[model samples]
Target: MPTAPALSILDRSRTRSSGSDADAVRATVRRAQRVEALGVDGFWVAEHHGVPGVVGSAPTVLLAAVAAATTRLRVGTAGVMLPNHRPFVVAEQVATLAALHPGRVEVGVGRSPGFTAPVRRALGAPASADADERLAELLDWLRGRGPVTLRPQVPAPPVWLLATGEGLRTAARLGLPAVVGGRLLRDVEPLRRYRREHPGGRVGLLIDVVVADDAEAARRELLPQAVALARARSRGEFGPLPTPGEAAAAVGSAGLTGRERADVERYLADAVAGTPGQVRQRLQEVLDRTGADELLVASTPYDEDVEAANDARLAALVPELVGGLRTAG
Candidate 1:
């Protein structure tokens, strides 16, 4: 059997209803410091423009903080949305970070547009922008194949694609590693096909995971994120996470429609939340199903102390998953 996969964290800088957006960003940096001490492999931040629930709109900027605060943790974006910016600029930002951090920075790119039409307009991203073309352009600049050489010409950081359906094809075609999550995980055929086509390209599974003393405690920690997602689907706006008590009240409130309740349940069902033993079993099953090379935990609970404890437990549970499970093939 293949060895256990490497483990990493992707913090979305998810805002809590009790805190401001600035607090969330600072918390992400602090969390990076804590997790680096915990001996995890890598720490990544995300980019989400105009989302109430997320404050990580500038991943490169945030990663710089994370990289500086931690001596050993591999820090990167998960990622910078290709459609929202010029490829040359993105390359410059990544190259700058790599020059400063040396062998510690990784770059993940995605094709997702702004969260809403107005946000997209503000970003000047057209509805029909060619993300594949933009991704190719970004790769060209990063590889020194563009018309103008990328400045500060340091070694290009490793690049990953955040794979959805089209993204899976793009990553396979380009022979790049893919970070896949959500609904994509429910079907293993695409993941299998990607590995087959790329012939040993790395596959990283991104999922919501919370670890606590027992199953129910972990579920409570996961509830706020689930509630945020459910509200996003029903109300068309993803707001900051509520506390566990707030989430429970919201779940049971008469104001919550049946559809919203169903959405919350569905989101919770998709996550992996339990005691260490249960999480380990669930993670092993996911790895077996997807043949993944790495695991990226994407859960950001409402409480920082609880989140820190969760990270510690997760690191302890999967000691073998800390680093160097398998290299990108």
Candidate 2:
């Protein structure tokens, strides 16, 4: 068993209220560079299509840019949605990236289709598409079992399932590692079952983890994302991130309905936000309960400076959370 869990970041390239989509994409690249300099283990980008709140639609393309901008930083998609793409094409793209970066590229794939009816129509993603079968086919191509061999012919990069619930079973059945989040983080039975079923398979947790001088300040940084989730759930549209002050104002001015208020609270409740010591304790509890092999921080604050600082703070705190290595220094 590994002595320490790997720590990484997943940036969704979220567009802030003050910036354009282009700015958001550029900011992702910059964030990748910043985290790499802080000794972060890896950087993953997300895929979203026609979402007003996110700009990371083309994950592989953005990953290519991120890879080019940083040396020694493992880059990947968090991931590419299989239902919206052809398995062969997805295999080809990841193969090319692996060829270019050698040991520095990883590919994670998901079953999600478009986020809404309009986006689904735009992508022509059929609602009935079989994601499990699609995932099997994608694996075949990546493993060189397909009719046509992928060009540049590099070794297949590591593949991780971006999953929850049934997806966990699928990953375990296929003997692949999984990155899971949401309710799965809170409920350990499924995660424990996955570990038992696939003893060699690795599990990663995706979470909103922030560190600040005080617990309140840390949670305040997560308010914007919680508000975005609330809006998405209640109004069917997730707008760009608002400043913490703006989010608090919305809560105060009856901008959010009772249901939306409850949604925001629920979202915040699921996040791990606090001072460094508090965050360390909460994360350790989570890691122990879930037996995760990796921790993927997925927090994005409205302030870029705060985001960067939090990344640095998390990096500084990671050494203390590693099991036997906590007291090494």
Candidate 3:
């Protein structure tokens, strides 16, 4: 296994009340450059529409910008919601991106309706359509089994499934990499099952992380975003994400008390928030339990108030996490 945490940026634009779309885009591009300068391995742009805060509706377009701006960091989608798009269109777009960047793209696929119902309806489908089948069809198109050929004919980027359980099984059967999130690691059973079933390939683990001097303060800033996201995800809101107003209403109606909300947020942070020592220990525990070949850290600095300060804190935490991985190895 590599000693360093395979770093990647999860760009959500992170709009404050005063920020505009241009401001968010500029921040994302600048942060992409900075993350590459930090020796991070790659950057993954998310795709969400209808959401005011997240400006990454077209992750490929944003990735093109990142690719033009940076020299080394790999660029691709953490995922593109396959069900919302036709297979051929997605295949061509990704192929064109690969043609431009060449071996620097990683495609992560997920089933979640990362957007709202109206958006899904606008795309000509119900949000509850079978994503697994759509993913299989997309994979088939990428593999050149479809009757229509994607032009430019770039090699297929490495495909990854952003799930566990049967999704991992699908990846194994298809001979693709699978990315397991920290939230799903309740036990080693899934990982063990994946390894046993997928002896030929590797598994990638993604953890939500925020490293700062004041853990409490970090949590305060990060919790609202995480809670909002978790609520959306749990309710199957896919495509472009819901507006903040929409998200707020959903979360508010869930009947969670202030303390319950706080507790869930903290729990979400456990995957990736704390001092260097704390993060290092937690990462090691995850590795021992999961046997993941690569670990991807999704560092969420949700709070805008401490954005600059948290950037520095994360920069300081990187080497420690890397070194600790080396030591543990």
> Which candidate wins on TM-score?
2
Ranking by TM-score: 2, 1, 3
> How would you encode candidate 2's per-residue C-alpha lDDT over 1-329 as one tens digit per residue?
34667789999999999999999999999999999999999999998887889989999999999999999998988998898788888998999999889999999999877477787778767767899889999999988888998786888889999988888889999999999999988777777777777776888889999899998898789999998989998888878999999998988888999999998898888899999999899988887677777889999989999999999999988777753221111
- The alpha-carbon deviation from the true structure for residue 279 of candidate 3, after best TM-score superposition, in angstroms, is 1.7
lDDT of 2 at 117: 77
Tens digits of lDDT, candidate 1, 1-329:
55657778999999999899999999999999999998888999998888888999989999999998889999889988889888899999999999999999999988876467787788877778788899999999989999998988987788999998778888999989999988877877777677768887888888989988888898888888888888888888799999999998888787578998898888888899898888888877777677788889988878898999999998888754332233222
Colliding pairs, model 1: none
lDDT over C-alpha atoms for residue 40 of model 3: 70
- Better-scoring candidate (lDDT), 1 or 2: 2
Task: Answer with 1 or 3, whichever has the higher lDDT.
Answer: 1
Give candidates' CA RMSD values in order: 2.3, 2.9, 5.0
Per-candidate local distance difference test: 0.86, 0.87, 0.66
Model 1 misplacement above 4 A = 320-329
Candidate 3 residue lDDT tens string, 248-267: 45446764456556655656
Residue 190, model 1: Cα distance from true site in angstroms: 0.5
TM-score for every candidate vs. truth? 0.95, 0.96, 0.81
